[model samples]
Target chain A: MDRLGTVAVVGVGLIGGSIGLALRARGLAAEVVGVGRDLASLQQARERGVIDRATTDLSRGVAEADVVVVCTPVGRIAEDVRHAAELAPRSALITDAGSTKRGIVEAVERSSPRAAEMYVAAHPLAGSERSGSAFARADLYQDRVCVLTPTARTASDRLRRAREFWAGLGCRIVEMGPAEHDEVVAYTSHLPHALAASLAAAVPADWHPLAAGAFRDGTRVAGADTELWTAIFRDNRGPLMNAVAKLQDRLSSLKYALMNDDEESIRRWWSDARARRLLFEAQQPPEA
Target chain B: MDRLGTVAVVGVGLIGGSIGLALRARGLAAEVVGVGRDLASLQQARERGVIDRATTDLSRGVAEADVVVVCTPVGRIAEDVRHAAELAPRSALITDAGSTKRGIVEAVERSSPRAAEMYVAAHPLAGSERSGSAFARADLYQDRVCVLTPTARTASDRLRRAREFWAGLGCRIVEMGPAEHDEVVAYTSHLPHALAASLAAAVPADWHPLAAGAFRDGTRVAGADTELWTAIFRDNRGPLMNAVAKLQDRLSSLKYALMNDDEESIRRWWSDARARRLLFEAQQPPEA
Candidate 1:
């Protein structure tokens, strides 16, 4: 793996803090700079040894950096990337850890064509409902899947650099187009969050205490931060709506089977579900 | 708690085997007998120290037992309890670990009004998607919720014994009517399983590898045994069906919000879900 001179991590939240810690722990960067809107949070990250330097000024943080990684929420990712373009070194590889890529990629490319050559949008498929620097961990991305949504506008060198950066943190690299990444994650991530929220709301508060493994596991993601997820939902609304409609259509079929007391059909559905879930369980990491 | 001279556990699979292990570990019973249709499985239970004895003959297993627990699938719980009533000692406490209460309780009382004096319907809110005796653990029920559904015909002494028996196994006891148990679990347990299956079935197979925490957690219960869960869904059809319908209705609200890009309403739903899930997490055991 290639070592870096300076790495600026914008937003200094869970994803940013983890990146800083991983880079610092591996001795991969000469300097790891934490940049955020809140000086207090960036100071806390510095105090906790997540970063060697803390700065509220994005320009001061990335002005001399070899790589700039933006780990802000979906809504702020493109703006931060664009801001980095104005000050970051011309040779710097600019990347982001946004959950949604198409909107950000398009927005950044539309603003400045030169920025696309330096930017390669990526999403690491490992995060918890809990957020912030407090919950960040150095090994958060180890052995997890990280998707790189590269466009034709993306420079080959910068794409490779983004892949190496995430790989250095122990992520298995995968490449998909921006639209495809959005579609796949609409079903894989966003749709499940929508379903969890709906499932959590459907159960009455009085009956929640008796809930055990099934209820707890099923509704786990409903504990996620509302503001962050709501923006992702709106940003990727088209594909998410399609996924939600498909789930409803499938539930309708099961509903009809239950209404008619069609044991054979219902059993067939359960059998398929059990087989599918087993296959998924096998593909996941042991702890997952 | 009163010590048991002998205990017969029918259908010694995951639930029955766990009960046998817990009883043996706590020295609650003199002998824990395993009974099932498969002599091979019963023998395996014995070999693994999950039970003191193994028998394919249900009558022989329960003949001299002080307590007879029917841990069979929902479809056969009533039949097993009635069989025990005919052969077990007059002092035996006849109980079941069926997920649904009203169906089993009504069937037993209808068959022999005298059996109600000994029978108690209970649902131990434990067990895993993985079945069979191999996965059984002595601590499976520790600090878990176990609801005892006592009927009007249920003898006061038998209900007390049932409560003591589960509590002895480290359960947190809750009392509800047979009908109430079905309704509560229909929302808490059965609805979640149904949603998990529907969600699992909706996602394309190729996209499964990309599924991270939300998809895995949301669809965890879909891995449950087909025959066992199908029987539960059928046995608790009225309430379960109502629960499935309510989930579909709730998903519709989220779908509309997505279609219209209604950020405010979507955030509201997510906010409510987060609060409800926090309350549930607070109530559940730490390991859950």
Candidate 2:
């Protein structure tokens, strides 16, 4: 596989900025250029050493890049792909770092007519409650799982290079179809975000001051950028909605058992959940 | 208020062991004696400097203690309270660190029929994924909240002493009725655990190996000891069951919006949850 050379990262937010830092810090990329809407933020990212050259002009950043990673919000990925495709160097591999896959894949297909065959759908499964480039850390991806969704049209050589690119950044690469990826993440990630958000809403303002560590930690992810998650849930509506329905059904069963004072039912309900969670928790952290 | 001196911690597992260590490190207690079901665990606690002494005999530990704090599973709190009550010094003030309030309050009432005036129902909202004496940290309670349930029958002097004791250990004390406390925690704590468990169960086994950081962090509290959480849920059945019903209804509404591709409804469903969660998350590291 050809070594990932000059790279352009569109949108120097937490995920984008961190990927740039990690690529450079790991010697995976010789040059890392950043593109963003805010010129001042790009300059800040450069001064902080997240990128070698930073520009507000998407054309300037992607003109000579060998690899381009689109890191815009779900709603805007199509526009970004279109912009990057026009400026991208010939044979440059394109990919994204979005949470949902199907919408973004469709966006790429529609926008990047030229780079469509080179594009791959990827989601790097790492983030912190803190946002912005200032909070970006090169080590954030270490031992984390990063998923790649490649369609039948995607070039084999490009797929290999994308896998190598993430592997170099210390991520264990997991490949799946875009549809399967959405279904899995809906239950594992999106549903939890929704649950946390709802739990926070249910608490009265008077009692909020007294909310303990459990509530705070449980709802921490609920504070994630609203616009971004709004688009994510909107894009992955089918699978996420399915997961939500399943969860509602289970919760309803538990409520009935509790309301009816069915001690045996309650005991079975808790024991089952406990068994699976404990097993998951016991798994070894991916080989460091 | 009488100075907290020679605090006795019964059943030195996570909560009890940590309390002993925290009291000793902060000089909140002159001496701490650890009482446990297992002699080896008690011995380990003492040797680890969590307590000044260790004993398997409940009577021996309670004889000279100015304050006795029971930290065991809620199912056994009554039996343990009765055992310690028989040997507790008449002037000693007794409290517990169980998750449930009403059941434990009733247990304290029944166990110490004569000395019930000296007993206070308390629950300190501080813990970790790690358990046992080995995981105990001195500053575990720093900036944490502790709830004190003082019924009309509860003595004012006993309440004052319990508050002072917790305050010295770096807990901000809040007053609430047993019923109210359980109701609030049902949404804030219990229901969240149930949600976590449900989400964990919903994930496919194949995806379990590929579970990412968010899934792990989101479900950390869900992997709680089954026996402990079971006892707590059962003890606070009325409130927990009520909260579960509300959560299920809310979740069902969310499912409906998602299933029907109702963008406006989904947005409204998540907007309030997101706003409230953001507000809660904005309150970082509570005032020390």
Off by over 4 Å in 1: A285-288, B285-288
Q: Score the docking of each candidate (DockQ).
A: 0.84, 0.57
Worst 10 residues of 1 chain B by lDDT: B279-288
Q: Fnat per model, in the order given?
A: 0.89, 0.57
Which structure among the candidates has the greatest lDDT?
Answer: 1
lDDT of the candidates, in the order given: 0.90, 0.80
| The candidate that achieves the highest TM-score relative to the unseen native structure | 1
What's the residue-level lDDT of A190 in candidate 1?
Answer: 94
- Categorize the docking of model 1: high
lDDT of 2 at B83: 68
